[model samples]
Target: MIDSHIHADTRPYEDFEMMAISGIEKAITCAHDPLPMKSAVVTLEHISRLQKLDVKRAQENGIDLYVAAGIHPRAIPTDYEKVINKLPSILNNPKVVAIGEIGLEKGSKEELKIFKEQIKLADKLKVPVIIHTPRKNKEKVIDTILSLLSENLDESLAVIDHIDDKVVDKVVDRECMLGLTIQPGKLTIDKAITILEEYGVDKFMLNSDMSSAPSDPLSVPKTVHKMRLKDFNDSEIAKVSYKNAEKFFKL
Candidate 1:
């Protein structure tokens, strides 16, 4: 199975072992970003090392891990141009697949500007994207994404992660990929099953969204089990659990 999204950088080698044991053969991991107020002095080059180490650690642990690089919402500063400028070199890394976990969390003007810049950067690099919409005003976030994506932007090359029930329908259109986070609090097993049952797993993917918090890395694999129990057939389960992500990440 492939975990479409995860913060594997925040975890240890044992965590990769756990993911492998849970049947997660591959995963897309995000680079660590220093928050705005928290670390305004931190440079992108400093944080980029963490991303390199993440890929190396995953390989050492025998997991097929891909990296996504971006300044996440909570990590964006008032002036992020210097950070964004460093993306081209970071993106040159072979394992880097997408530019993301980028989107509005606070929905501020500066945040939107940075988000737009990264979207364009991803397009210029000809790579896919992984977006992180705010947990509360997700519908607003989706609308913002639709408006910002230029005519040349390939909607099929992006996935909006950490989506909730309220914005599910609005995000499931042909515009972009839809991601379901299997974290304990955000999206439970039952909610995921229901979303797949209703959405029919067309442009959908599942992620653990597991962070340093008390989240489950096995959530996606466990959800696959529950899906079978609920009578979802093999192809249907594979579409959401692995195939969709495999194609989305172009693995």
Candidate 2:
């Protein structure tokens, strides 16, 4: 199975170890360079350094862990140009699979500007994008993406992530693959199956979205188990847990 999205913040390496033990064969580790926050943002430079370390560790352990680099919408600000300029080298990394976890947030105009710039970079590289949509402005983000798709006609393999029941319909309706983050409080496997039944599993995929707070890297299996309880056929469960992600990541 493939985990579509994951961060390095919460118990980073431990999360992948748990996933390997849970039968996940591969995982894509996403990182964003720190932002110049009132405090400090985890910059892309830092993420690059850490990604190399994670890559080495994964190789040593015989686990397939890939890396993706991008500037998240929340990490954008006035000096975002400097961060944007450094993206080429990041995308060129041999282990980097896609340019992602990039998209709009419910922030100021400056943030939107930066987000658009990153989207352009992903387009230029012809790599897939893992979009992070804000809960409130999902419709707007979808519209923006649709516009880009219309113009490019060759829209990258995009994953519109963090989708919940509220926006699942619209997301699936657009024919964009939806990435459901399985967190204890955020979303339950049972509810995700219900959404799949309502929306169909053709464009659906699952991820742990595990963090340090409290999460399970085994969420993919847990979700599969819930699908079984719902009487969803094995083929359908496979599509959500593995097939969809495999096709998207081109694994």
Best by TM-score: 1
- After superposing candidate 1 on the true structure, give the runs of residues whose Cα lies further than 4 Å from its correct spot: 32-47, 150-152
Q: Give the best candidate by lDDT.
A: 1
Q: lDDT value for candidate 1?
A: 0.79
Clashes of each: 0, 7
Q: List the residue pairs that clash in candidate 2.
A: 33-42, 33-43, 33-44, 34-41, 34-42, 34-43, 35-41
Candidate 1, 1-111: lDDT as tens digits: 998888876676898888887788999887545334344346464346556777778777778888787788777655578778878887777787788878788688878
Deviation (Å) of 173 in candidate 1:
1.5
Give the whole-model CA lDDT for all candidates, comma-separated. 0.79, 0.70
Model 2 over residues 83-197: C-alpha lDDT tens digits?
A: 6787787767667877677777765566556666776777677777787776677676766756655454245367788788877766576646788888865578877877888
